[model samples]
Target chain A: MNLVIVLLIIGLLMIVAGCWCLMRTFHLLKMTIGIEVAMKAVTLFLVLAGRISGKIALSETFVITVMVAEVIVAVVGTGTAVGLFRKYGSMDVRNLKQLKG
Target chain B: MTILSICAHGFIYGPILVVLIYNLFNHEFARKHFFWFAGTGAVWQILAAIGGFTALNQNGQTSYAFGAFWDIRLAGAAFFELNATRFLLLLIVGLVALISVLVAHQTVDFNRSSYTNLLMILVLGMNGMLLVTDLFSLYVFLEVTGLCCFIMIAMFRSRADLEGSFKYLILSELSGIFILTAIAFLMMKTGSLRYADLAGLGQRISAGSGQLEDLLVYAALILLISGFAIKTGVVPFHSWLPDAYQSADTAVSILLSGAVNKVAGVYGLMIVMQLFGDVAPVGPSLAAVGIISIIIGALLAVRQPQYKRVVAYSSVSQMGYILLALSTGTTLGLVAALAHILSHTAFKSTLFTNAAALQEQTGTLELKDLGGLENQMPVTAFTSIIAFLSTAGIPPTAGFWSKILIILALWQAGSPVLAGVALVAGILSSAYLIRLQRTVFFGQTRPELAKVREVRGSVLTAEVLLTVITLGLGLLYPYILLLLHAGGIL
Candidate 1:
């Protein structure tokens, strides 16, 4: 129980930090990394949830599936960032204002 | 398996088969004849959904559960279930996909094979989302759908497309994380993620089982709501919507606005309501969001110069009505929400189809650059007017009936103020749509646009087909109400 609680606090703090990184970063790749960080924290939460509920097997399956999905999202995000980089000659999010209202 | 089960299974397997067969052909042939493959898959889905709905209704089954080559009877196993609501949504998916295919035939010039492949994958993802019986599976399918959308938005790799796609990716992934965290918290509380297990969770939370459990549940609820709100593109979370819609090709935009948002975002919210509705703040919070989205979406829409941006913002506004109806948490509210979703699918697709037509002919979608082409493109003009009428909830159009049903549902749910506000939003909708119409169609024909001609082929067919659906549903809505009354549901 102590271990689970310790992990929970660590996981949540990681998410907050990840979100902070996501908001503070101007580089497109950094945003993707921030998102990945938050996703990993959620993965930890899933494991912790399983530990609390005595359904580690179920949560293990969920964690694996989520990892796969997160990887795909990362790949797509990075690819889009590359495309944006080629278009704008920089990885800066500030250059992404062409479609504004 | 029985025939109805076979039809249900087809929703999952049909798209896969299309992808396989589409790839079997040579690249050149597949590229040239992509429409037949994608179109047939869409039409098959539509027929299957209708068949499944009718068969399930005749047998008096609320839900039909089946596993895709797996054992659903095992403890804690994930599976798919088909019910009336899923059937309705699946039908919309099929219909919007068909419209997107029709528009794609004209608008998507390069990467035709990739377009067909991605579109099928998108349909598969949406079908999976609709069919899943568990929260975890829903999230997986939601990501599948989101990934397909991001890819399709950036398919052409244009500067604008890449920007829009990137913005959508970041926000969508953030929402995904939110949903995952909520799912984790829910699992911590309930020990399972299945719909059956999660039912009455709100009652359990309100039963005051424990302080920690209650806090966890509340946290989960908040996460789920905001996550799905971002997907639904309502109010403050809607910044990505117009950008994505405006930057993508019109065919892709049609799918984004007409179908994907509803299936991915609104449907997820519906599940949230189904699960957590008994909580004290759930319904009112949703109502507040709904009202804000309606007012702000319209206000933003009125200021856009691009044709697709207006329609996109209008989508945000219309989504608010559905949310408001769903927020009522009554049987009538559910029915009204479904009706509005169906009508919105038809009219919104029509408006986007008109966008395709205008873009193809006038070579631009800027309202300022466009002037009177009413005579030049009579079909597109007439269809646009009908769609505008529906958007404004004018008489004898499907939007009018759906909006009325929504107001009635709200009133019956004892929120007369919301009902009245929804009524007034109809006028606001008209104000923007009229301005849109007057600027693009009713004004004097600019010298540059004087020679613009009507769009032919599949685009025109989509326009007429969607217009008929909007009008037909409106005319038939009365009988539908009577049928529900006869069935003792109203």
Candidate 2:
């Protein structure tokens, strides 16, 4: 049951989720969720890849490390969102164009 | 110590050594020690480069990692590749590391300890980026660098700076997805994660891959290149750069443009270039990107009202030169690219520091707001003029010689059109840079700005140091090139 199809679906969904977060959502929190969903897809693909290739331990280590890194990135993303909300009075990216040419 | 000892011990451990040293003392106690790390990192980089150069002279390329870190079954490990590309890359990293401490001291005055700590991580990330070889570690180091960049940009948590950092975060995350997907495809196809292994796989593909496999490989290559290009801000992928550079603190801008982009983008491309031997599509596509970035960056820079944004757009143009040089896929082109790497690092860092000085003194980076500080701060005026000239590829500055070399290399490589376009774009950059000079330094001092005085202390020190190097390198490139050739670095 766990095969390349499963891996392919996860990766595709993650890419779609990332695209949705970036292209559709104007809100920072949702964008962060989109990033998390997307990276989870990458993590699953890596582990399944290791399973298929018979290098489960190595892939597991990579997954664990990636999880930690993803968390940090998410935390930073959320923190920045909070900062943006406080300073700009909105979480919308369109409103944050004070530094244009 | 011998090169082997440092490569085996220090190169891998140097950043850790820096981190441990930072953690051993309180932030106040550890603030200036960051300077020591940067200084020592430069010395160690030079030693490692000498070692790498000598080794490459004897052998071709060397890869080293602790055997303990390796799973005997799996080939990839925590590793570093020392070849011509890395030799120059490390030296550039060393230069950025040394300058970053100076930038930190100037811009970060409050809660200095926290600044030092974050900067320590930043330096660690760059050092890792220069040294890491495998694809997985490259992504990790890149993210580490990215995280540090986000924090540094929004360190003050100003409304504008935070937004810039968030934009950067989003783009970087997007690039990350692209890279990881590409990497997964690569590993699934190649069954190995190491560059050496990739080379073997590339040979197999070149010998004759199925149409589907070939398409997959090309798709993966596109994804990987797009990831690096986004980081590099090469033309169509450059929206994040102006925002990031403009909204960040000036010192942060110096470090970001001077060092971070080179490590993350240029070095990333070089590593991937290793995998792309004799691929027919690589060169022409790369050249097209170079030209696009050059023209767009030059034209956009001409209209930028803010000084920081002008320099930022100009960086997009300069990076185009490097990519174009690399796209030639010839040894001379690579050499020219390396020279441009050094030249850009020196001049761009200096120019950004001067921007900092301008901001500190005049309190405005908007060109239309004020002008004519040449009479008040002669050093800033003079050093910045030299930097501007260097950036515009004016003669007697290092940029001039390197740009000429790139054009010459392109011509020799049978691309007269590109060479001519590069020349014209070089002139276009000068037009904007001159406009910049006329507006910022050469104009009449505004009534309110008449009392501006010369900047003193560490900021001036950073500007003067980079200024002298940019000027000195311009006059001294021929000898330097000869030396590099002799050293087997070119």
Among the numbered candidates, top lDDT falls to 1
Overall local distance difference test of candidate 2: 0.79
Docking class of 1: high
TM-score of each: 0.98, 0.91
Model 1 segments more than 4 A misplaced: B206-210
TM-score of chain B of each: 0.98, 0.91
For model 2, residues B1-490, the per-residue Cα lDDT tens digits are: 4455455355556666666776788666666555565556556655766675676567544554433244434545556545566667776766666676676666666645555556667766876777665778888889998899999898777777897899999998888888887776676566556666777455556525454445657777888889999999889999999999999888778778988898898878777775784666767878888899999999999999999899999999999999999888777888888889899999989878888888888888898975888899899889888988888888899999899889988998899999999998888898889988889888678899988998887789888889888889898988977886796645
Mind giving the per-residue lDDT tens digits that candidate 1 earns over B57-133? 88999999998888889987888999999999999999999999999999999989999999999999999999998
Q: Each predicted complex: what DockQ?
A: 0.91, 0.67
Two-chain DockQ for model 2: 0.67
Query: Which candidate tops TM-score?
Result: 1
